[model samples]
Structure formats: structure tokens, C-alpha cells
Target: MTDATLDRIAGALAGMVLGDALGVPGELWPREKVRSRFGRIEEFLDGPADNIVACYFKAGHYTDDSAQAFVVLEALLKAGTVPPAKTLADDLLEWVRSMNGFEINLLGPSSKASLLAWSKGEDAEAVTKLSLTNGAAMRIAPVGCLVEANEHEKLAETVARVSRVTHSTDVAISGAAMVAQAVASAVAGRSWDEIRTDIAAIHPIALVKGEPTWAASVLARLEAFEAMVEKLGDAPSEEDVSLLIYRAIGTGTMTSESVAAALAVALWCRDPWLAAVMCANMGGDTDTMGAMACAICGAKCGISGMDESVVKYLETTNGIDFRALAKRILEARANFTIGD
Candidate 1:
């Protein structure tokens, strides 16, 4: 693979970890609380002792978002593409098993529920029947980088195949597909307008009986992002931006909200570290939003744009070699060619 392509992949992965760690301490806090506690999260801070979920981890530690994405990365490296649903399901189940006693795992509701069903020997389809959460979109960075540019079908199918193992509902799958496509576009150096167009083109598919879809919600978030950005201007205060995102757009773990929040942050920050900082301070589901936004910005800017010390610190602390992961993904990328 070309060095440029590899750099983009590495940047995307490293950005994910950095964002996750940076946001760990601030997860779930409301904008008001976040502002009062830190003013603005300009650096990594340990999870506060009083916060229930945050206390499970320390500063500079990533939550299940990056951990699960790492699992997905390993699976993609082994399978060289989107693995079979059963195979992916097994892999995810094993991840839950490995984290059996570790409360820090912090698996999201959707993934936790689906894995619990799998552990009970339920069929995969049944396990995924009620999973309309952001869990699917949070861990789909590998698929984004591996999908060749302009290959929307490959992107969508790959996202669906992986997402269905944990999140089969229309909103989850659609959000995941949009994220993967946006990452692909970022890897190809597409403009924000092009990426936005790609995201807006996604169609939600209802796969299960009685499960509601978020097609309208997803579209509305997209428009909300555009409107918010137009009004916020290029240099809104961090407080103003955080409050707007939390109250106006919502920052919870829901796919319709968090994924769109990530996109909005990416468009506004346009830089990996800046995006990470902003999303970290925005509060609810901070790590996932930060990782998602930073991944996209990293794709646009490449790893060289990051601080060398911070990257090195993340690699040393997290025990993840993003460069090696990028290399493996590049190998997998070569095995599957997308047709124009």
C-alpha cells in the first residue's frame, strides 16, 4: 500500500484512541457540569471519583468504544473484509467473555443485550432484534478505511453485515453505514460537502417486525447540524458550542444524535486535536462522539498532523500499535478492490 494511504489509516486509528482517552473523564456530564468542572477539556483528565461510569477507568484510558473497535480491527485483519455474521458474533461474544469481571468494559446497552442473548445460545437474528443503538457506528472505523473511495455499495453492505451482528435496527444500520462512508470519503480527501452528500444519501432499511426506524430523525439531525453551524460561526466559544450541542442537538449514545453530533463537530473543528477537545467537553457519550469526530478529521489531515508526544503517549499507555494496525488493515485493503 502507498505510504499516504497507510498514513491516513494510522491517523484515523490513532485519532480514535486519542479522542477516546481525552473524553473518558468527561463522559455523561451535562454541558453545564462539564463547563463547571473543567471549563474546557484541553488535556486528558482521570475519570472523576464520583462519576459512576467514569470511575471505572483512569485518565488517558479509552472506554468500550475504542476497545470494541480494536476488536473489530483484529477481526477485519483476520478475515480481510467483513467477516461472516456468525464469525463476527462469535468474536464479539469472546470479547465479552474476556471482560467478564472488568466493570470497565462498559459495553453499551445494545452490545451488552445482544451478547447476553448470544451467551444464552439464542440465534443471531434474535440477538440483534432489539439493537437500535450507536454501538454499531462507534466501532466501524476499520470498515471505513478499508472501503475504497466512491464504493457506496461495498461500504453499505460491509457496514450492514457487521452492524447486524449487534445492531439490526434501521437507525443503527443506517447510522453505521453513513459513518463508514464518511470515513471512506475522508480517506479519499473529499470535501465536507461531498462527505455530507454521501451521508445524506443513506436510506434506512427496516429489518425486524415492530422495530422503529430513525430515518426522519437522522435526516433532521443532518439539517440541524447545518443550521447550527451556520449560526454558530467559525469561532463560537467552547461553552456556547457545548451547550448548543447538548441541548439543541443532543449528545446521548443514540445513533441518531451522537453520530450526527460527531459529524457536526468534525465540520466545525476540521482538525483532529481540536475536534477531540471540543467533543470531549460536549459531555454525553463524549468518548464515542470524540472518537468518531477525530477519526474523520484524522482521515482528512493524516497522522502527521497530530502531536508526536501525544501519539507516543497514547501508544505507550494504551498498549496499541496504531501503526501496525494500519499496516495490517492496508494489507486487508489490498485483498478487496472496489470497482468504479
Candidate 2:
């Protein structure tokens, strides 16, 4: 990969964490509730006391989203190809144990249950039946960083394997596939429109994997977002679109809602910083959607194109060395191949 691609990769790494940290303060609140507390939420603030999960984290600390994404990165590197579900689960279990995740309440419901089941020697595949949350979609961006967009079938299969570790429902894997491929497309220098189109093409392929769920289709939700945008008219302000999505497309933990909302917001905001801020203020599972949306924006803008102050704050506060992580991913990117 070229230096530009590396910069985009690094930007995506930083962007996901930045979104998580930035949005942590307002997470799980209603739109009105977040507005009542933080107003616009432009800067990183301490997570609100009312937020059970976010309250434990200080300002600029990423939650389980970025943490799990790192696990996927580790799993991929160790596997030297598509990460098997067992490898992914072991890595996840180790990370959770290391972080005291179970005691701390950092994990979402699906992840908490899935990991706990696996830890108790439950059948891993069988345990994933009810995991229809956004846990998989929240962390799958790393797969996009390593895999190419053109490898759609391989990407779908890889995502199914990674997601089946914690989230094996049809909607869950489909959302994860969209996120992974969207990031891959952005890294490959595809335009926003092209990336959106690619997501549509990859959705059904991913939908075929995993257990069936009664949840809404992720592709249909994206179309809802598209219709909402058309009704929004031209050049609407960030708040207008954010509110529209909050009321219509939703910003919750379900894979279809959160993942599609992230994609929608990122495509509309187009600016990495603004996309993250929109999600932060939009409320309801802010950190997750923010991470997803901002990763896409970061993939497009690269590190240099992001807001310098925000990037600096993210780097300084978070212990991660994003540039180093990006380089490591690049080193492994060319050698690891996802199989059909």
C-alpha cells in the first residue's frame, strides 16, 4: 500500500477510537436528554453520570467497541488468514477477562451472554443464535482495514466467521459485512456513492450466513435512510439530518438500526469530525454508531484530513499508538488472504 493508503488506515484506526471517546459521554440517552446535558457535544467530555456503562470511563476513553476491534486485529494477525471463530472467541474471552469486562459492565447484552456461554463450555455456534445486536458491526471495521473491497465473497465469509464468535444472526452478520466492506472500499479510494453501492451488493451475501432472526433487514433500513435524505432536501444542516435519523432510522443497539444509521450519517456528514459529533449528539448507543460512522469518514479523509485538535486529544488520552497499529496492519494486509 502507498503512504496515502497507510494514512487512511491510520486515520480509520484513530477515527473509530475518537468516535467512541467523543460519544461515550452521551451514550444510551435520548436525543432530548443528550441535548439537555451536553448541548452540541463538540469536545470530549466525561461520560454522564446517568450512563451506567459510560460513567465508569473518563473523558476520551474508548469503550468495548475499539477494544473488541483490537481483538479482531490481534486474531487476524495470529491466524495469518481469515480468523477462525474459535480463535476469535479465545481472543475475545482473554480481552474481556483482562479488562474485567464482566464485572465492569462494558460488554453489550449479546456479547456478554455469548462470551459467558463460551466461557462455560457452551457450544460456540449454538450460543450465537440470539445475538442480534450491533456488537459484531461495532468492531468489524478492522476487517475492512485488512481486506480489500473487491474480495466481496471472501470478505462476507470472513465477516461471518468473525461475527459468529459473538453475533451469528443474519442481521448481525449482514451489518458487520456492510461495515467491514465499507471501510475496505474507503481504504481502496472508492467514493462515498460507490462505497454505499458496494454495501448493497454485499448485504445479501452476508445475510446467507448465521442463524435466522426476525429483525429488520439492514438493506431496507439503508433505503429508508436514502428516502429520509431525499425528504431532507439539499444541503441540510448536520443537526437536521441527525434528528431525522434519530426519529426515523434509529440509533440503538440493534445491528440493522445502528449500523445503517452510522453508514447514513457518515455519507451525509462526509466530514470525519462532524460525523462523530453528530452521532455523539444524536444519542442512543452513540459510541457505537459514532465509531462506525467516523471510521468510514476517516477512511475517506485520512489522518491529515481530520480535525487536528481532536486527533491530538484522541492520541494523547488513549494509550494506543494508532500509527504503529496501522503499520502492523499494513504489514499483515498483503500476506493474509480470506478464503472462499
Candidate 1 residue-wise lDDT, 115-197, digit = tens: 77676778756646566678988998778898886777677777777788788877787777777777778888788888778
* TM-score of every prediction relative to native: 0.91, 0.97
Give the clash count for each candidate. 0, 0
Model 2 residue 196 distance off true place after TM-score fit, in angstroms: 1.2
Model 1 RMSD in angstroms: 2.9
Q: lDDT of each structure?
A: 0.78, 0.87
Worst 10 residues of 1 by lDDT: 202-211
Output the TM-score of candidate 1. Answer: 0.91
lDDT of 2: 0.87
Q: Whose TM-score is greatest here?
A: 2
- Kindly provide the TM-score of model 2 when superposed on the true structure, using C-alpha atoms: 0.97
- Model 2: runs farther than 4 Å from truth? none
Q: Give me the candidate number with maximum lDDT.
A: 2
